[model samples]
Target: MAEVKLHGFWSSPFSCRVIWALKLKGVEYEYIEEDLLNKSELLLKYNPIYKKIPVLVHDGKPIAESLVILEYIEETWPENPLLPRDLYDRAMARFWIQYGATKCADAIGALYVASEEEKEKAAKEILEVLKILEDQALGDKKFFGGDNINLVDISYGPCAYWLPALAEAVGVKVLEPSTLPKLHAWAKNFIEVPVIKENIPEHDKMTAYSRSAREKLGKN
Candidate 1:
């Protein structure tokens, strides 16, 4: 058996992505929960550049960044594949995942710390980015990977789970049936997956945490 270990924080969607990938692939890994306030020395040692959580250590090699870890998990396991087998499909999947990482994520983060006067603008920006994703990448597919969850889905896990909590915390609605219906449905289906449902952070707890984070950000 391969020695696998994961360093992560509980409330982070990025950490949840690694957990979901490991569970889906049936790879056994020891999970180490790190406090973001005071990061573990091992975490700092492993991810010297970023010093962030969601670092996966397979055997003795350490891989940092959630998306990078997800790819490593897929390539390492290869049994229950998280990426598409087709070359073009794989490329497209990666493209959408990158899009979410770059475009959608910024808007969502902006919304989280937006002032009362800036709230509407920030919310609109996220909605617009998500709408593009819904129409272009997702379309009518049940999942980003069509029949099953894949890297794309895992990459956007925050949009499914954390975004709603952040919206609630910041007093704005982004993913709603009234606005982005398809994406809204996608969120519902994504979370209901047994691996996702079982592994995700508690919603109420996350919402409270987001509220506190927003307040702290406001102070800064």
Candidate 2:
């Protein structure tokens, strides 16, 4: 029997990325919940470089980073292919996923912890980023991978869940249907997927945690 283990934090989008990929591939593995506040010895040992969660340990080897782990999962378990078979399509998916990680990810942090005076600017920045995604990356596709969810979709999983939750917690919205009709609709569809819907952190709990984190950041 193949031994697979995943160490993750429930509230982390990066962690969710790995979770979604595993679920989609129908791979059963052990899940170890980490306390980000008090890091576990195994987590530290497994990921000494980053000491981060979402580490996928197969047998005795540990793979760190959400995206890296995702790729590993796709390659290892080829049942439900998260990445495309065509070379060009796979390259395109990687490009967009990198764009999302570099561009969209930080914008989320800025919006989430934006002070009252900075909120408008942060929201505007987020809107611009979302616009790029909608117009260029997403276009009119139901999902990033057309009909079925792909690695690109999983890569941007945070936008489906955390983006809206952070917007609500911050009392400003950047993904309204009127402004980003297609992306907004896509978000709804992304969340409705059985695997995604089942795996995400609860909305109310996330909101409360986000609000608390924002407050803590304000004090520091």
Candidate 3:
């Protein structure tokens, strides 16, 4: 048995991504919550350069970056496979994972501000990107890896868990059933998965935190 520990912010999608991966693999680990505003000295020291949460400390060695951490976990546990077994399929999975990561910041930024015009523009752009995901990546797949969730779904973990709360906080309906039917439905299904369901932050709690963050930033 190896000592496994995680440093993360409870409300962070990045943290949640790692959490979901570990749980999906049935790996035992301890969770250490971090304060983003006042990052722990340990977190900064462990991840000196980035100073980001969701760092996995395994047997005393630290691994940062949620996506990279995910690959490490999948490689370590190997029980429940997150990436596809085929080489090409694996590459495709990684490609989509990176795709989601690139788009998420813009999607989230839209709601992070309070300007009505900016909000609308952000929402529209975000939804447009999301539409491409549904139309191309997800299509009619029940999960990113077919019947079950995979690294691709995990990569988009934040979008599934946090988008609804953000929509409420920003008072918009961007992920509507009509607009992004497949993506919206996939989000619902993804959150309902056992591992993700148990590990996610509470809905109301996230809403409050999101609202407070926006207020602090003078977004409202």
The pairs that clash in candidate 1 are none
- Per-residue lDDT tens digits of candidate 2, residues 1-220? 5599999998999999999999999998999999999999999999999999889999989999998998899899999788889999899899999988888888878888789888889999989988998899899899999999999999997788787778877888888899999999999999999999999999999988888888888811
lDDT for each residue of candidate 3 in 30-57, tens digit (9 for 90 to 100):
9998988899988998999999988999
RMSD for all candidates, in order, please: 1.4, 1.4, 1.4
Q: Once superposed on the true structure, which residue ranges of model 2 sit more than 4 Å away at CA?
A: none
Q: How do all the candidates rank in terms of lDDT, highest first? A: 1, 2, 3
Report every candidate's CA lDDT.
Answer: 0.91, 0.90, 0.87
lDDT of 1 by residue, 1-220 (tens): 5599999999988999999999999999898999999999999999999999889999979999888898899998999998989999999999999998899879987887788889999999998999999999999999999989998998997778898888888888889999999999999999999999999989999999999987888722
Clashes of each: 0, 0, 0
Clashing pairs in 3: none
True-structure lDDT of candidate 3: 0.87
